[model samples]
Target: MTVAERKDISNYLNRPYNIIIKSISDESGDYYVARVLEFNGCVATGETREEAYQAIYEVLEGFIEDMLEDGEAIPEPISDDEYSGNLRVRMPKSLHRDLSQAAKLEGVSLNQYLINKLSK
Candidate 1:
C-alpha cells in the first residue's frame, strides 16, 4: 500500500481501535506468520503480513458495530509505549540447569552469563 493510503486508514482507526502487527517466523524458519495482538477482546492471524493487518481492521469494524448495538462504551486508543515493560521468557528445566552449570563453571551468575552471551 502507498504511504498515503496507510495514513488514511490509520486516521480512520485512531479514534476507536487499538491495533498491533507483528511478523514472526516458525521454529523451522520455513514459514512466516503475521500476528495481530490485543484488538480489544479479539485477536487475528494470517499467513501473510498484509492479510493479517486487513483482517484486524475488518474484525475491529464488526466489533465496534456490536458494541454500538449493545450500548457498550468503546475503549480509547493506546499510546505506543502503553504496554512496554521488562519482558521475561520461560526456559525448559533441563536448559535452565545446563545454563546455570555453565555460568557456575564460568564463575559468573546466570543472568550475567546470559547477558554477556546475548550482547555478543
Candidate 2:
C-alpha cells in the first residue's frame, strides 16, 4: 500500500469510534467481547476487559485496512454534539391519550412525564 493509503487508515484509526465491551460466560468460562459499532462484524474477545479492548483495536486496524483496499467507504464516528436530544416517536392514539391523562394526573407535562418514564 502507498504511504498515502497508510496515512488515511491511520487517520481513521485515530478517530473516536464507539466500542462496546460486554462480559459473557459460557461453558468456555467468563470472558469479555469487544466490538466497534461502526464496523459491522468487527468483533474480538479475550479473558479480560483490557485484553478484549486491545484485541478489538487490533481487529479494527485490519478491518479498516481491508475496507480501504476494497475501496469501501469508511464510516466516521458520530459525536454526541450531533444529536439534538429531541426524539420524535410515533405511538398509537390510544396510548398517547393514556399518557396524556396519566401525566395530567401526576401534574406534569406530557413531555416531562415521558422523559421521567424513559429515564427509569
Candidate 3:
C-alpha cells in the first residue's frame, strides 16, 4: 500500500522504541542531545530535556515521512509485545551462593550487582 493509504502518521509513530538522550554541558552552557537509536544520523538538541525530546520526536517523524516519500525502507518501531527484558540463567548452586554473598556485602540486589559487574 502507498504511504498515504497505510495509516495515520501519528498513529504509526506512536510505539515503543529506543531513544537515547544524553546531557552535554560545558563552560559555555548546557545542552540536551537526543536521537532515535535506529534512525541512523537523525538527531536533535535543545536546552532542556523536554525540548530535546520534542525536537528529536519531530525529527524522527520527518525522517520517517521523507523515507516513505522517497520509497526508502524504514525499520519498524520496537513491538510492544516483544522484548520483555527478562532472562533466566542457570549456574552452579555454589556460584549462586557466592553471588548472593557478594551482593549482600555490596548492599545491592543480586541482579543489580550482577549488572554492574557485567557492565564493567
**Candidate with maximal TM-score:** 2
User: Can you write out model 1's per-residue Cα lDDT over 1-120, one digit (the tens) per residue?
Assistant: 467745644564566444566676777553233322434455566677677777766777666566656777656666676776555869899999999999999999998898899889
Candidate 2 lDDT over 1-120, as tens digits, reads 899988988899999999999999999899999999999999999999999999998999999999888889999897889899999999999999999999999999999999999999
Write down the TM-score of every candidate.
0.44, 0.89, 0.60
Could you tell me the TM-score of candidate 1?
0.44
- Candidate 1 has an lDDT of 0.66
lDDT of 1 at 1: 47
Please say which candidate is ahead in TM-score: 2 or 3.
2
Question: What tens digits encode model 3's per-residue C-alpha lDDT throughout 11-98?
Answer: 6478665788999988969999999877899899999999999998899888878887798877777565777868799999999999
RMSD of 1: 8.3
- lDDT at 52, model 2: 99
Candidate 2 wrongly placed segments (more than 4 Å): none
Q: Which stretches of candidate 3 lie over 4 Å from their true place?
A: 1-7, 79-116
